[model samples]
Target: MKARRQRLILEIIRQQVIETQEELAEALRAAGFPVTQATVSRDIRELGLVKVPGEGNIFRYAAPGETPPLRRDERLKRLLRSSVQFMDFSENLVVVKTLPGEAQGVASAIDQASWPEVIGTVAGDDTILVIVKPKKLVTTVLQRLNELARG
Candidate 1:
């Protein structure tokens, strides 16, 4: 039952811009799950749901690693433009320098972009280490990052 309800929650968020726990609980009830607020909260946490920017100033819940592709790209572009001070690469490793307290957010945006070339990223207070596979692709990744930073 829990699994089924959580699945429904994922589906609901995908289909609609759910903005609050109360809204989620209502949707669950509409779907016949009859959940309490606490249950809804726990399910959100267990599902690793995140709030991504929505239209205008609104934000809505999204499943882990599931920000829509266009929005994800826009977010990455925005982050790179605003927070990144410089980027450099060597071999298969790309280092991104961001303003203090911005590295983690910038890295998260990069990870969320889901670029095939990126293997993983590690972030500190003002730097991100982005690892790319197939050292030959480092240039391609760097080019893409530069474009995003410029935009």
Candidate 2:
């Protein structure tokens, strides 16, 4: 039932501009789902819906793009460009800051990049500890992070 409702939520969002949980709940009710605002809210989170900019400066819920494996790199690059707040390094550890709740995604992107200098990454709520192969390569890793953040 949860999966079906989530699928319906996705369909409704794709078909129209759903800007709020109330609006989404109304749509779901109209579709015979008998939903509450809280249920709709949880469904939205479970669906990985994001409110992105739409026409006339409004934001509307849409599905995330993780379904397409081919766009993972492009998604990573875009996430890095938008969420990377600051980067610095000491010895073989490069530290990166991101907006709250974005560190994990940024760290995952860094790990997916498979850069020769990166040994691994540990992410927190808003910070990432990136392990480098050698202390000497810290500068190189930092430079690469800077470039990703810039573009």
TM-score of every candidate relative to the true structure: 0.58, 0.52
Candidate 1 Cα misplacement greater than 4 A, ranges: 1-66
Cα miss at 7, model 2 (Å)? 42
Clashing pairs in model 1, backbone N/Cα/C closer than 3 A: none
Query: Please, what are the lDDT tens digits per residue for candidate 1 over residues 88-107?
Result: 99989999999999999999
Model 2, residue 82: distance off in Å is: 1.0
Per-model lDDT: 0.91, 0.83
Model 1 residue 149 lDDT score: 90
Q: After superposition, how far is residue 47 of candidate 1 from its true place, in Å?
A: 21
Which candidate number has the best lDDT? 1
For model 2, the stretches where C-alpha displacement exceeds 4 angstroms are 1-73
